[model samples]
Target: MPSSKKKSSAKKSATKPLLISAGAVLAAITLGIVSWQATAPAGTGSSGAPAVAGPRTDPAAELKALARRESGDKLAVGRADAPVVLIEYSDFKCGYCGKFARDTEPELVKKYVADGTLRIEWRNFPIFGTESEAAARAAWAAGQQDRFDAFHAAAYAAGSKEKGFAEHRLVELAREAGVPDLERFTADMAGGPAAAALKKDQEEGYRIGVTSTPSFLLNGRPIAGAQPLDTFTAAIARAKAEAAQR
Candidate 1:
């Protein structure tokens, strides 16, 4: 009878383990539901997260701060005096910008900037709010760590998903991009003139009448939206040709 009771106790223990597993699964699902509810973009439900506001029109201190905090001389992937400068004002949350980063820019870098015919300068226009600003700050901080290009590619590689651009996500993206000093990077994100630089980019974009993502300023010529490869090729060629003539 004692042995029978022992066997019964073992059976009960096995059932208890199963119950515990089921509870864990339920708990995970519940947590996921709560997190989803909290993070769902601005208007999914009455209880949805609040809307993310873009930059304000305050005296443009963010831009100035960014410039001051910027450690490098200039963010050119090629020669500064390259015949053509392709200034891209982009938002990380922009699909077209992501496509350009993934599809167009690689070939362009190889053909133009890498070969020294064009200089590519990226400006962050964080029109998407906290997440966007955080992403830009991560990139700037990564740049300080000498991994700007890597971080940029990582940020794009993280995909064009909108709300995933939060600070923690940016840090993860930076990690994927091979940023060595994660702690230092995080600290830099809060420090320096990051806010100012970001603000300035937005103000400058506003001043220049930029109303779209992935806008191109080819030697100061405005090209709205993402155009095909040939359009950029032609523009670069034209700029270089004109420069040569001068």
Candidate 2:
């Protein structure tokens, strides 16, 4: 009887340690679960957290979205059904573009576009970084107030005649060109139609491999560089010939 009692006491002592170890493991698990629940993001249906989404990996989709958002009531001047379309990819900060604005654009506008022989569309390709983009946006804002051509002429003239165009200088030009409300113009540039339109132009230019300013596209055929007047004349002639053939 004494031996049996001693054995039973030993068994009880062993069982106590096992029970303590199991309880400790269970307590640790409970604390871990509580901590996870406290720190997880809200709206997670489960007790634990959901994984976060990665960054957008499609560049083409992003550009398409930008183009869609930026093309706000974009206009087409000249005959609606004109056979030859002259798409001019111009940069506000580009010297060559300034030259064209001075010499080529007026001739083209007066001779071809105004005469209804060609459709002229201006796309702003602001490739000279932030300042170019800003200038283009400001011009777009000026357009909102029906002063685009005037603002464009002044800004390009400022770059050509006086000095390289600056942001402050463009603002001055806007004011001088009789933009009714300078403050509203500036604010529109900050966040309105102008910004969106410029972005659209930038995207279209990128997609079409326009890396430089004052490039022209006859229909969809690109004319690289700031080509001469003769080149433009030839292109116009070719476009007219093609239209006749079609």
Candidate 3:
């Protein structure tokens, strides 16, 4: 006959391993859920960031106010009279900003800018540091010679930021972008006009609640990321429809 206490001991041992395995699985599942929630957009998460702003009451008026719409502005593209405007506040050193510039912006230019449906206004909101400020100034300097868009493309080319934007690198980029006068580019980058231009762009961004790089205003509606191409296409379509009714 078996001893009752010994049988009890065997039963407990059999269940102990099962209990440990179940606990581990439960812990792993809980951790996965936490990670998923953490990766959601900051404004939409429990991360304590400010919530995304709701739609504007007077989107068209606010949009018109921010559109600049200057034909001589080298940092802007498309027709000044385009029905939809996309104002981008970005940093030269931000990786995501580069992603949008390289991956998304050209597509927008091709589809909408070429057709006179959209205008893109670039705002120099340099949040990084001295290099960022310098790059912004340099881009503006390039614009003095009518090469701002080219310099912008070179600055945001893949692997460009890893090389850094020292004064010399900026000059090299200007050369690549075909600025007509290297002497003028250097002088303008260090001049007061560059500083003033940067200040104006930065102030505009800050006033409109832009606290991050690559933020955008599409006809006065805020889009806070380098979202998918469809996001932009949809925004442009909606803005165009609304403009037609105005």
Candidate 4:
């Protein structure tokens, strides 16, 4: 009886991370259709529309807790101790995600990330099937070579998503990003680390109730959709002020 109990505990311990990773990936690919409809109302839709900005419902503690603040994270930009962190849950296949990447993200990178006031950590929450997942993995692989931002720009370049993310296409994007080692890029994309990294981001997004692509958490208060620059700017300011108080 003790042996059986030990075996069950060992199994549970071994399976926990796999359960979170694979389960969340499967949910993003499958359950997302239903989950999005159910959970998206708190945030914006896929069209970059804003949710009703009523009184803030998310608690201050939770909002502040979302910042990873990891200096070594290649997928993130800005100082680790940046006063405000914007956690973005996005998919490569999402139109609004592309829109934000193109139009809004650059300005934020310039005004905030450059100044070391706001940190942006990307979450891979692919919801558009195999190709989207592939793109996410490719992006994560690019991060391994310290070219994630460059890869991000190329992947989200005007009309890039329309081209789709075949293995060759992803390789092409990696080249465009100047990833230095094409052979390594290809191998890394299919390797275990990329899958594990993608799974971790996806599970965190799901756990926090993100139901749509381009969903953002500015200090943990959910901002659904690809909101405008002003919306993000205001949220960043509030988060910074709140952080200062602490």
**lDDT agreement with native, every candidate:** 0.68, 0.65, 0.82, 0.81
Stretches > 4 Å off in candidate 4: 1-60
Candidate 1 structure quality by residue, lDDT tens digits, 112-184: 8778898777888877777778888778888777888888787786344554877778888888889899999
Candidate 3 wrongly placed segments (more than 4 Å): 1-60
Q: For candidate 1, what is the lDDT?
A: 0.68
lDDT of 2 by residue, 1-246 (tens): 999999988988877421123233333433433444354466451213453354333332222222221223233356755666777778777777887788777787788878778776778888877778877888777777777788878887744435555667777878877889988888888895676677777666654345566766665455655556787888888878877997
**lDDT head-to-head 1 vs 4, winner:** 4
**Deviation (Å) of 173 in candidate 1:** 0.8
Q: State residue 69's C-alpha deviation in candidate 3, in Å.
A: 0.6
lDDT of 4 by residue, 34-149 (tens): 45435556666333367556533433344456577899999999999888888888899888889899999999999999999989999899999999999999999999999999
Clashing pairs in 3: none
Q: Return the clash pairs for model 2, or none.
A: none
Task: Arrange candidates, best lDDT first.
Answer: 3, 4, 1, 2
Checking candidate 1 for backbone clashes, the offending pairs are: 62-195, 62-196, 62-197, 63-196, 63-200, 65-193, 66-193, 66-197
RMSD of each: 19.2, 26.1, 14.9, 16.1
List the lowest-lDDT window of 10 residues for candidate 3: 17-26
Q: Number of clashing pairs, model 3?
A: 0
For each candidate, give its TM-score against the true structure: 0.68, 0.65, 0.76, 0.76
Q: After best superposition, candidate 2 residue 162: deviation in angstroms?
A: 6.0
